[model samples]
Target chain A: MSIKSIAFIGLGAMGAPMAENLVKRQFRVTGFDMRQEARQALVNAGGHAADSAKAAATGADALVLMVVNAAQARSVLFEAGALEALAPSASVFLMATCPPGEAEAIAAAVEKTGRHLVDAPVSGGIAGARGATLTIMVGATQESFALARPVLDAMGDKVFHVGFKPGQGATVKTVNQLLCGVHIAAAAEALSLAEKAGIDGALLFEIMGGSAASSWMLKDRGPRMLLDDAPIASAVDIFVKDLGIVLDAGRSAKTALPLAAAAHQMFLASSGLGHGARDDSQVVRAYRALNAKPANDP
Target chain B: MSIKSIAFIGLGAMGAPMAENLVKRQFRVTGFDMRQEARQALVNAGGHAADSAKAAATGADALVLMVVNAAQARSVLFEAGALEALAPSASVFLMATCPPGEAEAIAAAVEKTGRHLVDAPVSGGIAGARGATLTIMVGATQESFALARPVLDAMGDKVFHVGFKPGQGATVKTVNQLLCGVHIAAAAEALSLAEKAGIDGALLFEIMGGSAASSWMLKDRGPRMLLDDAPIASAVDIFVKDLGIVLDAGRSAKTALPLAAAAHQMFLASSGLGHGARDDSQVVRAYRALNAKPANDP
Candidate 1:
């Protein structure tokens, strides 16, 4: 309850708004990002800006990593000396999506340095981030969760404590991405087939959006899939990475995830098709390519 | 809308209630089914009982074939003389989930007999049927749709005129089944991986049901998945049959539906494992079997 000072690393699309939310909640947020513009944006929004992750973490009550993945999270905490720089027993909230095994390993190393680690991965994308309505899944001991709760709540409305084990949150996130990735691809697959049959893609989605077939991804991503181009919310490479983490989690658990594995292929194909940086909804392009007619069948 | 009387065939789970909804709305509904009890149940609900499908359609204003599939629909209209039994130019509402090609064939045969054909397929299952909340998708000429609208609306709150051609509605329904099937199987694949990692299935779904990973199927079917003996809302065999129609539509369109095809195998496996008639959520058993650890691994 006494936590006040916080370190926020990686001020990209998701992290910047999250740090701004913390600053609005009266936390002494010191945000760090390699981009000078990103760092300056935080200071302009009434928070401190650090030149490096270690400098950001100096004696902070908590460290929030919104880095791209576990490797960057690791470089911030260990390679960049952020974990050692935090105050004793300061909670290190790893909010990056990560593989379960990597999360567990990072937790072990952080705990070895006398700091608590809270594996908290989030979804709801950039819009969720800016609105402070992201769903955060936490896997940490009760004490660690308690220490991280107020800071966590400032950035997200729905914060679920999934388990007491370090890697559990990441596993839940891995599963989440598995469902999300598959549902998007499935929507694309469904819509593609409907289009092939001469059904209007937009109307088909409107009907399916209200039916039992509806998914959050379908409603949110379905329209974008119909577009020739859409503003990027999250890129195809993001799922390429997340679903890669998902399959890695499956491998670590010795579990078979046939749908996730198949969905991962579509994202991979999309990235290979050179839309890796396009909106993830562009995964439909892969479907269109796969099911495109013989070009002269008529 | 002078379609004052209707012949409702196949008074099974979904059909029986749809017929009753029509009767409630003051349509004189004559019903037929193989089961005497099915026919008697319709009479108890203030509808008439017919000895056969042809008898039900005798001079009726509309003939609604809510039969098992296109084959049964063909049998009722063609083999049982129900098409000829109807008054000339009466609308024939084929409100069954069928392959698009098959729906088109039936439409051609009906149009040749001077009866208007509405390729109207529905989603929302038995509960939707009972509540008159089924989502009905129609692909018919505007004239045919206008004639069929009143009775379709009596049975469904959301009656969509999807197209001006027969079979487009069935194609939409096929796509709906594709999403629903993959989502159900994907939910199983996701939760199975979570369970393998020692995460609570109930808790995982609770987290996911509120996140972007959510689907109508995940929310509706997820809780039942955690139970050892949940009541059947819809059975595994139903999805097996429906997804089969989806793949058939895809094949006929020369579309490659990898996800739908993969989801079908799981349902087939569940049926092959003797859980076909069980709640569709029991498809998780297939995931469990596929990922079960060796006895000596732990």
Candidate 2:
């Protein structure tokens, strides 16, 4: 039930906080990342730093990959020899938002190495990551889920077993991102209309938040959309990647996702407008450019 | 503050229940509609029945228009001579999902007749309407809002005064519909993909509904989507009207609403498939036809 030695990879904003939570919960955590500062933050939180993912995974009972996308998750666990380095019975939790197909492939590759693979993608933003209240959706054998329970508990408050397929977690996560991305863009569009109509955006937020139009994305991204400019937590490129996964998944299944496609285009337009690195709420900037002003100029 | 005498127009699913609520709450409600059965149902609920909207509005303290669209609202209040029949200080609570422009024009027309107007579009679906727990969004002057508050209390649990602008309530309602329309379509698309991927549709619904993809629309529409068929509470034609209003509003404002437009297209596709009068969740039927069944459809 205890994670004696765990390896965490890609300690970025989300991963760093999650890895720290694991360490703070008294797990002997070994973290690896190309970003020295990210790894250093995990190290400062009582986790050990490793030079490579393989080094971190060697002798660890569990390996958690929190990389940016499927490519990174694959590169670290499969390509970089980390899967081979892990103990035969070690459980691997892939928490990155990636293509479902890729998750399925990676899970198969890990399973081939005689290790348990937990397709665990999480929600709840940076704040949740640090506060250890994230929601983790798992698509794995019940055995693997049970094995990874302690580590998951250290990282999230809610852990659900979605299905028996490795890609189910990624599939559900893509759906979440599809809704989140579309809702955020929709919020921008509606708020822009309000602002163009001379209604105060703040008051609109207050009213809508309490109304049926309310969603997690609106409550989270609406205020940030009002900020003229702000620091980025989740960047625009994340949606570009996430929504691309959604569209690709839709296309693969021959299922048309018009709203997701439209949302994809806005994030594309936002990225195309050179705000890709900015906060995802910067998608509002696309709306601002299309409509005149969503807020009075400071 | 008491609503002793009132008229309720458009005795359809929502309007009939709402009219009954007024009667249940001790208001002397006069119900009007072209449908004899609809009027009879209201009369059975102890409300007076009138053959015309003007007949209902005449000498009443307030007239609540719960019609289908702006055209019906316009025909009743303007074209049908209801405005001329209502008392000078009588209030008109326009509680239908119509275009913001229509709401604004109606408000102005009512105000010129020395009548108070409250743009009070509602949410909570048919169930909410019947249960008297609908959420009402009001856009009226302080005096008008205060005047309509008692009647609103009879119909809804929450009444939000969005702004003093006549169209503000419709604008906010349109925003709510925008999210609902897009979220429902997105839920359909996602659930369709999950089904195509060989996952159980009901299980996927249970999983995603418990996860971050959860939204008011998704949770509300998801179960119905799983059924090959279900009763039509709201229909695809409804979204066709609502999302049409959304896209038109966005286009007139020159605001880019790519998500709403895309969601609108899905509803159009469903309508084209001849399921316009079926449940709006039947949008998934379009996906079902286009997508190949999972390998293990047993």
> Which 10 consecutive positions of candidate 2 chain A have the poorest summed lDDT?
A289-298
The residue-level lDDT of candidate 1 at A35 comes to: 98
Please state every model's RMSD to the true fold in angstroms: 2.3, 3.7
Across B1-298, the per-residue lDDT of candidate 1 in tens digits comes to 4799999999999999999999999999999999999999999999999999999999999999998888999999989999999999899999988899999999999999888999999999888999999999999999999988889999999898888889989989888889999999999999888887777888999899999899999998899989999799889999999999988888888898888988999999999999999999999989888987446532
Q: List candidate 1 segments past 4 Å from native.
A: A293-298, B293-298
TM-score of 1: 0.95
Candidate 2 positional error at A238, Å: 1.7
What is the lDDT, from 0 to 100, of the residue A124 in candidate 2? 85
TM per candidate comes to 0.95, 0.86
Error of 2 at B172 (Å): 2.3
Name the lDDT value of residue A197 in candidate 2: 62
* Predictions in order: chain A TM-score: 0.95, 0.91
DockQ of each: 0.82, 0.45
Residue-level lDDT tens digits of model 1 in A208-238:
9999999999999999998888889889999
